[model samples]
Target: MIEFTNWDILRNLLLAARWTIALSLTAFIGGTIVGLLLTAMRLSGRRPLQWLVRGYVELFQGTPLLMQLFLVFFGLSLLGFDISAWAAAAFALTFFTSAFLTEIWRGCIDTLPRGQWEASRCLGLNFKQTLSRVILPQAVRVALAPTVGFSVQVVKGTALASIIGFVELTKAGTMLNNATFEPFKIFAMVALIYFALCYPLSLASQRLEKKFNGSR
Candidate 1:
């Protein structure tokens, strides 16, 4: 067994943590974009579009994320597409993120008073104009706290990417444990690193919720 110095183990884990951060950010941003589109479709007042969006959301939200990652990684190969682990992880996580975010944002939008929509329509604002100028602004404020909170979930979910051979923090921890035969030490450090990344977001989410509630 190769003995890894404390510093060596930490440095490697820290380097791997960068990939975790990158994957989380990529998934969040891509998911946000897709989620917005899904939200628009749901709100479009067309039954077909709404049904499509609803089904899409349900399909992803109902399934296990680990399974989604597995499908993205291996299913692509079976279809004669060669994809990297990074791509597979990002693809799966983006859809997973989008599904949850769509529901979160939808709840925020639904929280708006019915009178707000009526008032906008009475003012001759079209659907797009009213949504852009009036409804979305308020919804965004309501959505911000929970969105930040859900981001912690996204960060944690990146750990599953390790199953697909993506060498993020969890993967690096596994590799170091194998080399150093110190699963407890390696995993504890991994947990600490994840906490360091996620705790502030949790605190901020709580603070935002409190602030928003107080303002109401």
Candidate 2:
């Protein structure tokens, strides 16, 4: 029944929050790039490319993220990669984020008016030009809210990284709880910290969605 002091627990949580921030940003950025590639492939006219992209999306989305992390951490080690937990966690999260994002963005893209594509083609735009200049620009407005909202999920998902020994906020909380025997205090503070990180992003996403919808 050790008592937990506010300042001590807050400082430790903040330090752990740094790793959470790092991992979240890493996964989001990496996954965004990969997701864009996946989106393009899914939209591509090639049958094989579409199938491949679909398979990739389904595989990651269908599997539990915990299992994916285990596969990356333990499975990769078995394959002789010698990867650290940090790398493994990041890799696993990137793929997990990419699959979800691709699906999200595909929905956005699909929401565009079919006339937009027809009009772009009428202007002599190739597939690449049509997507880059016409479809994507409109789709982006539709995509922004969900994309920002998903960022909160990315931040929260860093907790799973703790299981793989990534030393993020949850891991730090666990360590502190173990030392001080104050699980309630440690976890409450951790939840508060996560709320602080995620709430603003959620608000911003809502605002953006409202503004964009109004503009439309």
Candidate 3:
């Protein structure tokens, strides 16, 4: 058994936390890009495009994220691609984030008054112009709070990445526990680290929601 000093345990956990942050950021950014595209497609007003986007969203949203990670990591290997744990985790989480984000933005868009759309069209604006100049601007206010809140979920989701051999906080905690036989101490620290990271975002989300709602 290895004897890890308290400082040593904390230092190692802190190092592992960096990867969790990195993975969350990567997933959020990538998911935003993909979610925007999917949102656009869903809003395109063509039946086929709507159907396609719905199917894509449902597929990701309906399945377990852990299962998705498994498929991305091992399934790609079956197809002869050398998929690393980092790459697979990022890919899976990106799609997972995108699906939820697209839905969130869609709900925001739906909340807009119909007159806004009609006015934009009356001004001879095309769909793209109307969306960019009017609809999205309003929708963004509604989307911002929820988007920030969902990021906490993404951060928590990173724990599962450790299962596929991506060594982040949870994996680090397990290793430390095994080495030191200090499950309570090590896992408590792990939980504390995650709460420290997530609580601020949660507070920000609530603040934004209140601020926006007050203005309206």
Could you report the Cα RMSD, in angstroms, for every candidate shown? 0.9, 1.5, 0.9
Candidate 2 to truth, TM = 0.96
Error of 1 at 73 (Å): 1.1
For each candidate, the alpha-carbon lDDT, in order, equals 0.96, 0.92, 0.95
What is the C-alpha lDDT profile of model 1 across 1-216, one tens digit per residue?
A: 777899999999999999999999999999999999999899889999999989989999999999999999999999999999999999999999999999999999999999999999999999999889999989998999999999999999999999999999999999999888888999999999999999999999999998887464
**Model 2 agreement with the true structure over 1-216: per-residue lDDT tens digits:** 566687888898999899999999999999999999999998888999999989999999899899999999999999999999899989999999999999999999988889998988888999999988888888999999999999998899889989988899999999898979878888999999999999999999999999899486
TM-scores for all candidates: the values are 0.98, 0.96, 0.98
**Candidate 2 segments exceeding 4 Å error:** 1-4, 214-216
Backbone N/Cα/C clashes per model: 0, 0, 0
* Model 2 residue 80 lDDT score: 91
For 1-216, candidate 3 gives per-residue lDDT tens digits of 667899999999999999999999999999999999999999889999999989989999999999999999999999999999999999999999999999999999999999999999999999999999899989999999999999999999999999999999999999888899989999999999999999999999999999898465
